[model samples]
Target chain A: MSAVAQAPGPARFCLVLLRRQLTLAVRRPIEIGNPLLFFAMVVALFPLGLGPAPDQLAGFAPGILWIIALLSNLLTSDTVFRSDFEDGSLEQLLLAPQPLFLSVLAYIGAHWLLTGLLLALVSPVFALMLNLSAPAVGVLVASLLLGTAVLSLVGGIGAALTVGLKRGGMLISLLILPFYMPVLIFGSAAVRNAVLGIPATPYLAIIAAMLCLAIALAPLAIAAGLRISVDA
Target chain B: MWSFFHKLGSPPWLYRIAGTILRWLLPVTIVALCVGVTWGLLYTAPDFRQGNSYRIIYIHVPAAAVALAGYYVMAIAGAVSLIWKMKMADVAMKSCAPIGAALTFIALVTGSIWGKPTWGTWWVWDARITSMLILLFLYLGVVALYEAYDNKEAAGKACAVLTLVGMVNIPIIYKSVDWWYSLHQPASIKMTGDTTIDPSMLYPLLLMIASFYALFTCCLLMNMRAEILEREARTGWVKKLALGYRS
Candidate 1:
């Protein structure tokens, strides 16, 4: 009874929320595997569509890989708040003592862990399959690592805004894809620079800067969006 | 000042004020647009390098300028609406979206028309052009999100949040031509440096730019007036106005 009376601090609540999200995702293993399968299938299609030319595939691989990563992130973002919202836990979270800002970040952090982290980890295999140069593979992974965090954050804003709408899947892309452009531009540029033997740090640095900006700002928007969605 | 802001929140007061302002400003805007267009198209001397094809700058530059500025106006109004719960600002922000989108479309189309004669292509993925296209998407996104929601009030708040998120793109669009090496020319009218354009061309461009700003204001107020009426259709004053118009 005493334990129930003592509310967790914001940080503690966020950790608990994050762990709950990860455990929920872990139980549904198919959710973890869908984006990766989508990535591989799309990578296969590029070679078939553009022809079986190795040189062409290798040349286009950096852009191709980055675009697929972005699309996958976009697809998964719509589901971030979806199940919670459907189950009404989202309202409980909103009414909790912890700041919604940190709570929203916890949701986004879990999303990044499930989607972006796994995508970044497995991107090198897809990069090699597309014949992307060995040196650029590291940059591709690194760029996706930094870039997808920003994507997930931005995507959280869209998901939060549209979580109450019935047909939110298509509309979510329209709402947030423009916000995704900078990440796409710098992410692909970093990998492309690596392919050409140029210093990719500047591009990666710019993405890192964008990540900082998104981290600081996106949660506020998400919290507002969630409030509005819940109220509506 | 507080009373004035209080008055702004009243829908009937805003509707009447917007109508009054639009009556005079709309005519002046039309006149200035005509003079500016004629002055640009007929009075200005041809460019030595590109000949008359360069005249499209009169429309292209001003539209792009105002379209960029309109996003800030929308975002600021959104901020006001969000911060103070101002319904008039919500109307203003909502109104800005279609106007900004139309202006952005004009900028892109005029740019493409100019491109065909100057760059010898209908389009290129140049930095400035791409950024402007993204600006159009941002505006349309607000409109789409607004229409998607079942509740109008929630729609306004959602769009406010979205606009604030998309506001980061504005500075990037402004700096794209400078930041990237592209076929698009840099700004000729400098605030603190020598103006590159001739005075004859500069004067009409200035007039056009001013007219475009006025045009934006007129359109925004008119849009707000319409939105105000639609939103307030259930109110007593609106019904009174409707009956008064009939009699």
Candidate 2:
């Protein structure tokens, strides 16, 4: 009762929510593994479809890697708020003293950590599988690290909007995929520039700018979406 | 002003006002469109470089410009609905989607047709064209999102948030795509070079663009009138209107 009477500050609430999400995600190791597995399988499939020629694969490697990263992030984002909404914890969070803006960011932050963070870490292996140059592999990872965070944040808007729907899986893609284009464009451009032995810093800077913008703005939409979805 | 705004919130008043405006504006828009098209296509001199093919600009440019502007209209309407909880703004936003999508489709198709004559292909990965394609996708996404929700009120709100998000992203998308295109292709065929247009060609093009805006308004009002009727079917005013009662 005393703890309930003295509510935590917004920052503390966000950290608590972040920890809770990570702990829940960590409990289900398969969930964390699924996007990575998806990424690897897709990367392997591209070689078959586009021909197994090393140079060709290497030529297209940057785009192929960034696209797979975006898709994997898309797949995981739908579940960020689904379980909480299904279990009514989302409602509790809505009723909490803290503003939903920070709370929503915490959810997206945990999501980025689990999916985007891990994918960027392992992408160099996939980059090599596609015969991407060693210099470009570093840029691929850096771009994905920055780019997928924006994807996760934007995807959170779709996830929150459709979290209450029975058939939100396919619809979520239709809703948010357009918003994902800028990130994909800049992210892949950065890697492509590195592959061509040109400076990739400008593309990376643009992506970083997009990430900053998304971090500031996306949660407002996500929080509003959650409210509308829950209310409906 | 406040009274007018308050009156604007009344569905019956808006429906009647939209109908009244459409009664005069629709014919004017159609006539203006026909005049602009004929003048641009027949009266204007053939371009020295492209001949008659360049005249497609009358349709292509106007559609593309209005298609882009319609998004801002939708976003602003969405913002009004979100902030003011104005149901009319929701209807306005909802109505903008299909009109905007159709205009975007026109722009893309006309651009493709024009490209065949000028660029020697049906399409090119030019930045503006690609951005227009993405704009079409964005409009369709909004329409799809709106239809997916079972509850119409919530659907309006959800689509509103999506539009606002897209509004923020549109500039970034355009900039990034522009940079990406410039990086990949170095100064290929410019869509429109800096050559000064003759006033003879420019006047009709300006007229077409103006008429396109008028066309957009007409379509929006008609769509809104239908939406208001469907939504307000149970209201006495709508019932009276349907029964042909003037009052």
Candidate 3:
């Protein structure tokens, strides 16, 4: 879709923005990989500290993985608009004729694809390393896939709000982690249910509902936040 | 009627009115608090099972109730600020964070103290306590966001947005904490449900909760008065007020 570089239509603009974000992210392999590495290192620390008891490790794996994923996503989101904001591109985007809501969606979409999707993809390896049972791995990956998208969307609100601030690194976490708790709760619960051979669909359904709510609402907040941050 | 609404926008009017209201309301709040605390602490019958330790309920329940109510107050002030661009509402919203955080902290401390005597532990990640902890974080988050911005107006707008977002999430957070607790722990202790206790105990609790609400209002007005003075210090009215106070 982005290959067709015609007149800058709204759809084309969004596509271009998404493609630009992905391309920029791809160029910075280290930035893209930091969260994954954080994920792995934190997961590795668990076994070292908690002992190699498989049952205990497996029980905590779902919560540990979900929490680390939440943290990594939170960390990555703080930079979502930081560079654009600093370079004055964010102001241009704000001044553009395009709807800010759509542009914000594209930014958040690109972020989710880069950090959340990648995190979900690599979560199975972490799941195995943590000695999670085989059946729960599917639920683990599925929950992350859905849940991390919500984190990125919700986290985008905090990112947009703090993007203009000098010391947003720590403040973004405080602003967004309260919003992340429900996602973390349901995500891990789904996997725990899976590990126990119980029904996980209900928890997954709640997570999907959360994703839908975030998708419908978060961009509006993100747009408002960006406006405020830019004005600041 | 609408003149009163218009008057709310004027800082000096709000300051004067808040001062007048506080002059009456503050003493009433203090007296009510003393009466409620005394009634609950001494005049009421103790819990059949937990003895005098259960008396912590008076402070704990009111603090927790008022803390939860304080979020609504904060969020509603935030909404008013955002919707109407009311400077006074922004002042009210900003003033609310520290008071709410302090109340939430009191709730948490009292809950922990009560837990030590009842549950035999100083802390438990009980659903209510965990929710209170999250609420404290939410309050502190607003305060932090406000302080982080150099531009005061932008800080108010940003905090308003964040508060609105937190408002939407509060119910979900409460539900999830409840569900999480139910799944992980057996229902070892039942918190005060509706109408379970005798009227003797419940009366003092109701009085305490009512007084706590009054206390919250008094604190909110006092804080807003302070904020208005701080913001308007350079203005003519505030300068006159300051000279008058000094003289």
Q: Candidate 3 on A76-96: residue-level lDDT in tens?
A: 999999999999999999988
Better model by lDDT, 1 or 3?
3
Model 2 regions more than 4 Å off? A1-5
- Candidate No. with top TM-score: 2
TM-score of each: 0.95, 0.98, 0.97
Worst 10 residues of 1 chain B by lDDT: B183-192
Q: Write the per-residue lDDT of candidate 1 for residues A120-231, one digit (tens) a residue.
A: 9999999989889999999999999999999999999999999999999999999888888777777887898899999999989988988898899999999999999999
Q: What TM value does chain B of candidate 3 have?
A: 0.96
Give the interface RMSD of each candidate.
Answer: 2.0, 0.8, 0.4
Q: After superposition, how far is residue B79 of candidate 1 from its true place, in Å?
A: 0.3
Task: Score candidate 1 by TM-score against the native.
Answer: 0.95
Instruction: Give the DockQ-based CAPRI class for model 3.
Output: high
lDDT measured at residue B212 in model 3 versus the true structure, 0 to 100:
92
Residue A143, model 1: Cα distance from true site in angstroms: 0.8
Local lDDT at B45 for model 2 = 98
